[model samples]
Target: MKLKRYLWIAVCLIALAVSMLPAYSEDFFQHHREFRRFLQHHTGFQVSTLGALNVGVYEAAATLAELKSHGDFGLGTFEGLDGEMVVLDGKFYQIKSDGVAYPVKDNSKTPFSAVTFFRQERSLRLTGRMNYQELRSQIDEQLPTSNLPYAIRLKGTFPSLKVRSVPKQTPPYSPLGEVISQQQVVFELQNVQGTLVGFRLPQYLKDVNAAGYHFHFITSDRHKGGHLLDGAFLNPVVDIETLRDWQIMLPSNTAFEEASLE
Candidate 1:
């Protein structure tokens, strides 16, 4: 009888433990869901304004403060085609025609911009000498798919870097191609340390965005930067984040509404 009673107690304990597992698992999943929600809220994949082809709309639709609320890293242009914008570590900088970078005010506006709260999901160390095209080819091989958007950051020393910045435009602002043709300022920096803030969009987004990689450069001293035209990396750490979500904020202004997006 004692042996049978002891066996009964053992069975009860085992059943009790098994009964508790459901509650434990439910709690674990609840916490997991909450954590995922937090990440989604804080690290929004990407936020952009206006299509890339709408180059004539040279008015600020969003402020720096507003853009910061959405993301900390990105690239775009200032209002009135002021210059190339390079956003890093939650700070905004403008690279003007003088080939100099300046901190932009929170009240500063953006005609077109793309930003994301950067969170690296994968990284690789790029060694050996590589030009822009070769480097892009290597990165393309690593992408999980060509259908999504990616935010890429490269930090290292460059032996040769060529960049350009456009001057601000007035009324009847010309298209981006014309503006770039007439007033683009080119800068060639040698043996400098900087970071490349850029994005890679799929080909289907060509009408809505720059189809491929669009990168802007800013030096570590925060004194020089511009639209990256060409460059070669020495040994750089490449950080990449695959963006699964995208949001585009259209301009409410009359100019954007009337512009020919085609």
Candidate 2:
């Protein structure tokens, strides 16, 4: 009887102690639970496929406002492959072939793009300078697995950055390959402080999106950037968000229906 009483008394003390915790304890726990849910439910959304773009399907499938309902950070091309797209902090930007960045209107349309809510899982600070390939390789090594897609954002002052953009095509569209080679404009920027937004996708998604690392850059002032081709990071921090699930919205157009994706 004495032992049982003591055990009951101990239980009561524990319950009291828990109840005496600061009122914020409950709120903290609630926020923690919500954050966990965000991490688990983080999703990547894409509009149209690269294969469709390659086949000359330039019609808009989704508007900027519609995309906001899906994700805030991502990259893609405007309708007609007009320019490079760099999405940051829920703001959409169109970097034209002229190497100029413009704010995208909510009604603007995209033919091929991918986006995510950007719930960061980790951040990395490099100890030495790394170029495009080296930076990707390093990040690759740190990923939990090679099978999942990851959204990465890196901000820093770069030594050199090479980017390009394609001119907006007119009616009677041409294939993407031809447009890129003949109409693309490249820019070389040095000592520029900016944020690089991109993703690392698995090869299995080749038909749906970029198979490897794809990135776009925008200056800190949110102007003058394009599709990132190469760059050197000087020990900057990289933010990473893991996306275990994805949804792709195929265009409901004749071109997409008839494209020779095979």
Candidate 3:
């Protein structure tokens, strides 16, 4: 009789526990989703602005190490418009006018740069020969919307690539256009395997950032590349990292304060 009573109580306890589980399970899944969203919060971050560069504000807005703290992938120029900056897979490269991609020191600073912790939200497996313009168009068609910013990456052998890098500047810097026209060193590579890093910003970011695609290239060997002027991608797999938002870290220095930014 005692054993039967104990068994009855044990069954009752389990039935009560099972009846309470639905509420607990709902809360558990809700918290799990919140944690996953936290992990997936990718953002595009930048130091300085295109407006500042346009006005020749080529001062170190932030150190490379500080920039890396925000994200692992990006592109920008060193202090004084020195060369071109390409940050890929948490590694920073400086492609100087001589067309050499050198590893950047952490203490080095940048005048302008944009970076994001890349996590591919969408990917496209492209085919046939696609030049820069065609590649942009194809990506545009794949985009769900143009209102948001995106970080893009492509790694493969490029049939043709034309890139350029600018020499370092001194005080009394000239406008970016004039400097590029005067001292930009152009390099053309054939059948080069490498990675490309860049961003697609919205038109609303005009003065703060470029309104369209801007990319920088580095060879697969991580030795040579620069501002991607043109390129032909064949059967390339492109990855797009959707950003939750974008942020710009302005210079605390006087150049940014004194310069007239439009």
Candidate 4:
């Protein structure tokens, strides 16, 4: 009889618990919905004007000309304009040409400040008008104190510098090889500016006749492995060596011969 009583009590407890499940679930979903609504409504403007942009920073000179011709002069002036921040209703818009303010149609395109606008443009895309003040507040709360740009200096300079228009240079060795294991790795040359160059890495060394900057590549692989690759044809080479014992290697050509891993 006692066993049966215990079993009956257990069943009753489970039944009671089951009966409360629906109410709990309903409350949970309701709470979730409310939270979503709050985020959507309260921060809608903030979210929409996340990455508005006016022009690319690299094209600042040209953009400044355009702005001077078409954009609002009261917004700012151009020159020494390295970056830009397009804001509307106080939100982040875009990084672009310095000193040039584009006409923002809505609040959905602005980034926080010039620096953020430039960085954000690399990650995001804006389509509409942005609020300047609202975006600014969001930036104030979210960004680091030191990172926030003020009116004192060139605050919005990224958009103007974001322009990337270098002619493509297809490498002869389209696919560079990875450094071999056990090989000491060091940068022999890096053609970042692409001044004297060629398709072949060797040819570039020959043309420039100089060993460029070198960075040591210390890999964990016992067989010393590293990648000699670039996002663009930015040919950069590495020399291989053991961790304790390092060796210096330079280009075979006389011009590059002088290059040293200093």
Candidate 5:
């Protein structure tokens, strides 16, 4: 009995040591450290509500240490439910129904205050520390950049824009990059009967980032009404997460299916 008890104690010690090993703790510490560093350097974070039913909100926690870092940061309460609440710098930004982050753009753009924003609401503040995995997963889901095909669509007068698949380009960094090919799409502004006003399609687009894609559309004649029609197919960004919810234009990757004044 003495030997068995000693063996059990030894096993517990080993398990405890393994649990404290570097690998298990590394990711946690890494994220925590980065978050701390970000908060230290960038004190100008705003808290905002992100969703409607499943509210997930974000606090800018830090400036762009890396642009990709913009994709990080989220607060969630339930699984698969959008975390609509976000607290940053002690300010509260309520999530509206449109799934856009509004910084309490009232009176003066005085960066929302926790007291003012939540004054009228009956919801209580979240307890405990932020959860990174839950937050990260929620954030990733909201980024239109990650979910490309549906995230990016060509609608408008040019919904039927011709896409001719071409040979892929070889990036200096990629070994099998040659496997991926590109499509050359052309958009032209025409009348109701299909009268050509102008056409534009760029040779390349920089980083698209829906999952891993970039897009660029060239306009042939901007000086004329071409901008109204030809510009219909163009967008500033494809990923929705990178932009403020009420952004005038979607992120750089949004393409149009057809053009209309609406």
Candidate 6:
């Protein structure tokens, strides 16, 4: 009986030592460390590439396959200003100058884009009447701070919505401002149900991102949308997600490298 009890005790000690071994502890710490890093960085969360001003450099920098891996919700424009790009629920749609929304192919490319793995952190119901600026002010009050980036989605009906989509441009591209001035197509809709996808970038990111609210609207029927210019919301539901991390992929091509970024 004594020998048997001693053997049992010895087994327990061996098991304990194995559990406490450096290799086991190392693996344990390594796993947790990686997990912590993921939470801290929020891999594939919010990704933006090329500044808004770089539209003239090269419009198509990365493919849809690569952009989708970084985020499922966001907005951008296609190569050569072909159309407006809206990413919703993991699918990418292109709103062309013809006032139609089409599914972008996986091989499609974009010049400037911003996207995020959207996870709403807060929601609000906006009632009564408010124009674009008023709505932005109300949202500003709800924000925890203006120092961080935010992804905003407004769903429901809009009594009036005005938007524009620029046509495709060829090589020897003019500046974006000039292109939009000369080639953008405008659309006005009434009593439309749709969702507005947008982002509020901090002032510090002015050169790198759109400094204020940059929005794109897609109708409920998934047939129409473009870069938002003005709108009045009757009673819309707003959902917001605060982006805590950001990643940017720069272009390696010669066009972007030689472009005068000043």
- For every model shown, what is its TM-score relative to the native structure? 0.84, 0.84, 0.86, 0.24, 0.17, 0.85
Candidate 5: misplaced stretches above 4 Å?
2-12, 15-20, 33-262
| Candidate 6 regions with alpha-carbon error over 4 angstroms | 1-18, 21-55
| lDDT value, residue 90 of candidate 6 | 87
The TM-score of predicted model 5 comes to 0.17
Clashing residue pairs in all predictions, respectively, total 0, 0, 0, 69, 29, 1
The per-model lDDT (C-alpha) reads 0.85, 0.89, 0.91, 0.23, 0.25, 0.82
What TM-score, to 2 decimals, does candidate 2 have?
0.84
- For model 2 the local lDDT of residue 155 reads 87
Tens digits of lDDT, candidate 6, 5-68: 9999999999999878988889999999998655433322333344544458645678999888
TM-score of 3: 0.86
Predicted candidate 4 versus true structure: per-residue lDDT over 1-262, tens digit per residue: 9999999999999999999999999999999999854433221011100111111111112232222222111121122221223322232122232212233322222111111011111111222333323322332343233221121111111111111111111222111111112221223222122111111111223222112211111111111111122222211221111111111111123222232222
The positional error of residue 93 in candidate 2, measured at the CA in angstroms, is 0.6
Candidate 1, RMSD to the unseen true structure:
6.7
Which pairs of residues clash in candidate 1, taking residues 3 or more apart in a chain or in different chains?
A: none
lDDT of 2 by residue, 45-82 (tens): 99999899987899998999989888889999998888
Query: Could you arrange the candidates by TM-score from highest to lowest?
Result: 3, 6, 2, 1, 4, 5
- Best-to-worst ranking by lDDT: 3, 2, 1, 6, 5, 4
Error of 1 at 244 (Å): 0.6
Error of 6 at 101 (Å): 0.4
Which residue pairs show backbone clashes in model 6?
A: 59-111
Overall local distance difference test of candidate 4: 0.23
Q: Which ten contiguous residues of candidate 4 have the minimum total lDDT? A: 44-53
* Model 3: colliding residue pairs: none
Per-residue lDDT of 1-262 in model 3, one digit per residue for the tens?
A: 9999999999999999999999999999999999756544578888989999998999998998898888899899999999999999999999999999999899999989999888888898887898999999988888988999999999998999999999999999999989988889999999999999999999999899888899999998999999999988898899998787788898999999999875
Worst 10 residues of 5 by lDDT: 111-120
Pick by TM-score: 5 or 6, better one: 6
